[model samples]
Target: MHTLRLSDEHLIGLARWATDRMARVERPVLAERVLGVAGHRIQDPRARADVLTAAAEARLGLGHLPRHLTQAYAAELQCADEHHKAGHRKAAAASAAKALILAFHRVAHIDGLTSPLATDPAQFTGPLRRSRVLRALRAPRGRVTASAAPPADRPMRLLLVHSANDNFLPVVLDHYRNHPGVEVRVLDTAADPATAPLAKGLGRMIASGIGIRSAYAGQVEEALRPHLDWADVVFVDWCTAAAAFLTLVDPGTTRVVVRLHSFEVFSYWPHLVDFSRVDDLVFVSEHLRDLAVAALPRLREPDAPATHVLDNAVDLARSPLPKKPDARFTLGLVGLSQVAKDPRWALEVLRVLRRQDKRYRLRLIGDSMEPGVSPALDRYRTAFAAELAPLVASGAVHMTGHTDDIAAELTNVGVILSTSVRESWHLGLVEGAASGAVPVVRDWPFFADRPHGAHSLFPRDWVVSTPAEAAARILAVNESEESWLESGHEASEKAISTWGWGTVAPRFDSLLCARFAEIPAQRRVRTIAE
Candidate 1:
């Protein structure tokens, strides 16, 4: 075996010589490492440049890297600064370019390391010059074109429709409020008291498997027409009674977008939606889209409006609060009023924890879904109440009933728990994480084994398969107060930075813009077919 040895002084001298050589030339390794360390803070140009310079010096010391490798690094630095200025952060885009450059250099294919900025300036340019060029090229020549101006000066109106009042409505409203050049009007199908009596009677008739027209059928049309006439877009949330109402209404020239959360896939409403009238359908997860498409064949038809997966938007700013010192022993469950929430699983976990130490307790929040509404729901509700009653009576579980102030409630919760059988996206658990509660998510059973489900949606370590596993994880987290608080803080930071409204709103804007730009081919094909 060959052996090589160097004295400390010799090694120190060699390091100094390498540092001097790197300072004389531009290298990018150190700059890239620094960029990785700064992470999201690359939004600041000075910080980004510092990172780039450090990486450049490191690469220069390596001595054999290609020139374009350095240029690629510089291009990324410029792109980062430009994107940061444009308010996009562009972290993924910048990182991808850097990776491509490194990959190409490693394979001795430096020419392949071309920067998108150099090759496609129009991609980065505002208002995309190529799109305008294409339109000009496509236009008939010699026809004196009018000035490039909007055909009509009209405020863009949006009709906001939902099945019933819930937590999602306020968040949706907040996203679009104060948006430039748009007017929004909200309509709640379930809250229309004028149709209540008719709905109740129709509900009884529908239960008998008889097809009866809803008393509110005409009313839906009447309520929708004026808004549709004035609106550029109509956004309906949940494929429920509201979707049925919107389908019955003539959209005239307005674009219609419907959002389907997870639970609605199994509901009867999917059968009622008139896809012919819908212009777009939004899903929160790809798994949800797959399930919905499989369950509702209409959605799979080529003529169906475009489908999109847009994650649920969360307001993360309101999540973090000063945590109570005693919160380490506290496990919290928000939105416990539904059987799907499966608070009993949380109770089982609490029981396991109490066996280890009585310091553990579970907090149940949110009103239970009214059992009187459906017999199927009532059966599950009764069983859940029975399981929870003993725990509640023993003071091991505390029920807050329901409160509008979730942030305040979360301050006392150290661990946020989601013990749900199914969910589109558990907003409550995410909100709890935002509130500095260490999230303990139950692997949602409905889609646990499915691709792009809960496991894919959350950090792997945060998810658990059973009550026992969940309890074990909880105990491990609360091993000490300091560890528990640290975990909570980390979870909150992740929630706010990753899923917060500020980060997610742009995605929604992109989806909406794309939806608005596409005229549904279904509408044209259907017109011709008719």
Candidate 2:
């Protein structure tokens, strides 16, 4: 097979062909060609955007993200910045919003060549949003009173705010809701019809740096202000639109706490949050703290909210079940919907294991990737399906998609693999470890070279650089049933002791015990400066 060495001339022709509706079969290869060299070589911004857009379209149609993605993203940011400098506020806002969304999801928008983040330009420039920003910034530091003590007769009021994802909150919410010292109420911004649009609107305003007092903001204030006044300490999960929206209001005496997980760093949402109003900022891991501070400069300022690295609250009691005898040959990977999870890496590990022992099989424990999310994901899904086909057909791969009871599923998962390119803390991997399955964590590439990553996050022996290394580790552990069981037992003990809710919840309790100062701080939790 002769590989065509595509050059600038070939790319130019391909770009023309793309405009004329290139064959579906040629789309992936053309995207690869553009990404490999041609996209970067183009100098003119207009031409670059056009070429990159063509590449994006090709990938969306068939789906390998080429170097064109970064090129397009950079081009869009430059355009937004230039527009802002020229005083084209609306144009700049639109471009900035596009760039912001692009950073999180590859497509600027789905099928419309517009960003889902784009709103009425007037909403950002309107008096409501502008006045809110001005007033908040100009407000005196002493304006927000010290944390209000709960009424002498009542338990301290605690409000938990969440948006779309609440995987981490249910356990915490249940504990606090039942606690004798606290009263808990959950305000799901995503679910409330009155607040959902407001949440999205606030994010848009922050991304554009224009309005914070639009009609949307007013509605959000209407929905949240009452709750803000009622709570002593407010915990906002996922540092997303809802978190940014919280920064729009005066918390008065409420001590606001926000948790930053993995996704927010890659997005512009963190840039929008007013950290000064927040009393505490929580991160699930040390590496995330390192990245968040680097990504959001406000986090580095002296007046920035006190930041802490705390382990996620996980329920490990149900996970320590005895494994089936044949489970030693099965490798499990949970939550495969996100492309960042990189399930293909797990496939590679399985291939390496099967080369030596055909009995080794892979059990995927989550829903397969769904299409129409993004071009990047679609491309990954296309490639993944092709690679997964043969093994699945041969019965070497078993998929148990989207199970509510993972602990029940773990009975057959001898080894649980974390093959993600990035994660703040892989809850699935840790849960599997607690379930008496040996944990194999790929040295997550996104943070592997950083000072803190999978190696620092987990036991050094559990992190591997390659599929071969993972296979070797698995084979060594599964050399016999006794060794595998022993390894799993040790892993289970480590997870339960370190991250289980019983151990981690106290740190949260101490943080929330603003009025009740009886609880002592746990020694393990570290402030960001540390």
Query: Which one is best on TM-score?
Result: 2
- Backbone clashes for every candidate come to 12, 5
lDDT score of residue 427 within candidate 1: 88
- Kindly list the per-residue Cα lDDT of model 2 for residues 1-530, writing each as its tens digit: 12156555665665656544432554445536535455556555556656665655555454333334455555665665566566655665666566455444544322122222222212222221223232233232322455455677888889899888888998898998789988888888888777776777523565333542346556656887888888887899999888877777667768788999987776667756776667788999998898777656566656667788889987899998878878999999998888878889999999999999999999999998888776557777888999999999999999999889999999999999999877899999999999999999999877787889999999999999999999999999999889999999999999999999989998888787655354342121112310
lDDT against true structure, model 2? 0.73
Worst lDDT run of 10 residues, candidate 2, spans: 521-530
lDDT of 2 at 275: 69
Weakest ten-residue segment in model 1 by summed lDDT: 140-149
| Model 1 spans > 4 angstroms off | 1-152, 190-223, 369-379, 513-530
State residue 154's C-alpha deviation in candidate 2, in Å: 2.7
In candidate 2, position 172 carries an lDDT of 93
Q: lDDT for every model? A: 0.61, 0.73
lDDT of 1 by residue, 1-530 (tens): 11135433443343344334445555534533323333223344434443444444454334333333333344344554454345443342343234223322321211111222222222322121222221221121111121121124654666687766455767767667777755678866677664333322222222211122444556555666675666677788887767765665456556678999865654445544666667678898877787777556566566766787777877779778898877888999998666667776888889888998998888888887674644435555677788888888888888888898899999989899988877788889999999989999988876776776779888998999999999889888878878888888889989888888888888766655333333333232133211
| Candidate 1 backbone clash number | 12
Question: Compared to the true structure, candidate 2 yields what TM-score?
Answer: 0.79
